[model samples]
Target: MPGQLFCFGFGYTAEHLAARLLPLGWKIAGTAREADKRAAMQAQGIDAHPFPLPDPAQALAGVTHILSSVPPRDGHDPVLAAHGGTIAALPDLVWAGYLSTTGVYGDAGGAWVDEDSPLNPSSPSGKARVAAEAEWQALDLHLHIFRLSGIYGPGRSAIDQLRAGTAKRIARPGQLFNRIHVEDIAAALAASMAHPNPGAIYNLADDEPASSSDVVSHASTLLGVAPPPEIPLEQANLSAMGRAFYAESKRIRNDRIKRDLGLTLAYPTYREGLAACLSGAVSN
Candidate 1:
């Protein structure tokens, strides 16, 4: 059957997925944060609506697949608060996806974590995602929870940071993180749709995990620019939010996506992903 997708938050990751699915006989509809963006998406032939949707039932009219990139706000899921019942009642809805975060696993001391890892979030944002995942799972829908690591792609990668002179190389020893390109995220989501396994939780991350400073240095080398001088972790003046990222260190395992859904990451590491971003293969 031809698919109809309704994305609750048609932001960066969801947009990439829509780009892939639109040409394959998929009808896309979603909620955008701004009026101008909603108009723009409509011009692109999407059934886009304003967010905090006053009439979610209307927006959900013929949606067979639903994807939510909406993060929880103030300890509650906005989507579940507004239209959880409507979604539960939709008889023909085939799939629902929630974009979660690996932060829910808390600090693993640079150890690896998989889908079955325990939930122990260290930050408020991470805690909120954990709660949101549970709320979505409780709906008893054909739900797929994707726990993403650090997300970077296209205009959002380190190449953009280097060009803008905003890239930093904080030298925190043994601090490692896994990241997934947005395109890879879309591919994994698409694969899951083709092989729907309800109640599946997959980690959407690259095969290799590395320190932030190393990745920044690589981007600088690729751009032929002088890399930012490294500042020791203790000497770096970081905001609370930025420092929170340093408090956690985990190498996320992505074997489940490959094993279960047969998905392979187009960019298995930050090097390949940043290269693609610099080459104009992806747009902002």
Candidate 2:
């Protein structure tokens, strides 16, 4: 049955999910921080509203499913802090989802991490996610947690970076990063909604984990442009956030999503994902 979904943060991944569900006779509504973004979502038939809604109970009166993609601020999840009680009290709520990051596993030294892996986030942002996940789990809702890898699709892929002259080939030995196309993320979320399992944590990632430089080179090849010069990570002029991203080297294992949700990723690897992005095969 199609049910109304309320996403706490209707950003990139959430928008893709909404696109998939809308065609199936599902009603989509969510919160957007910006007025322009809210207007845009409202124009697309979403019951858009600002964050920290003044009356969340009224806004989410008939919502059956909820998804929170909002990251934590200062070690706290804003959504849960503001509206967790109202969400927990929703009489018709069936399923809830929290979009987390694989960084919760921290640096596994390029080792593969599964859902059973311990949380050992290294960065401050990652630590905040860990805290937020804990808070969400404590709530009295049928919640599923998704620890996503690097997200890229459509205008957010390396193709855009290369075209904009921001693509970099940073060489770091023994460093591999897992990534999932945004479309695949949406598919996985939909699959989970179909097979609602409370208290389940799944990793959303692709089959292959490769170096950042390799992805950039492949994107350049697809664009028929010269690849950026390979530079050592130590010498690369990366911001603190970029440096933090490179600090972790672990491959995420996504067996649970397939085994439990019965999902088969359309773009199994970066090759197919990038090709789809280049050909405009996604809904974005």
Best by TM-score: 2
Encode model 2's per-residue lDDT on 198-248: one tens digit a residue.
999999999999999999999999999999999999899898878999999
Cα lDDT of model 1 by residue, 51-151, tens digit: 87878778788778999999899898999998999999887899999999999999999999998889988988889999999899889799999999999
**Candidate 1 ranges beyond 4 A from true positions:** 282-284
lDDT of 1: 0.90
Candidate 1 matches the true fold with a TM-score of 0.97
Q: List the residue pairs that clash in candidate 1.
A: none
TM-score for predicted model 2 compared with the true structure = 0.98
Worst 10-residue lDDT window, candidate 1: 275-284
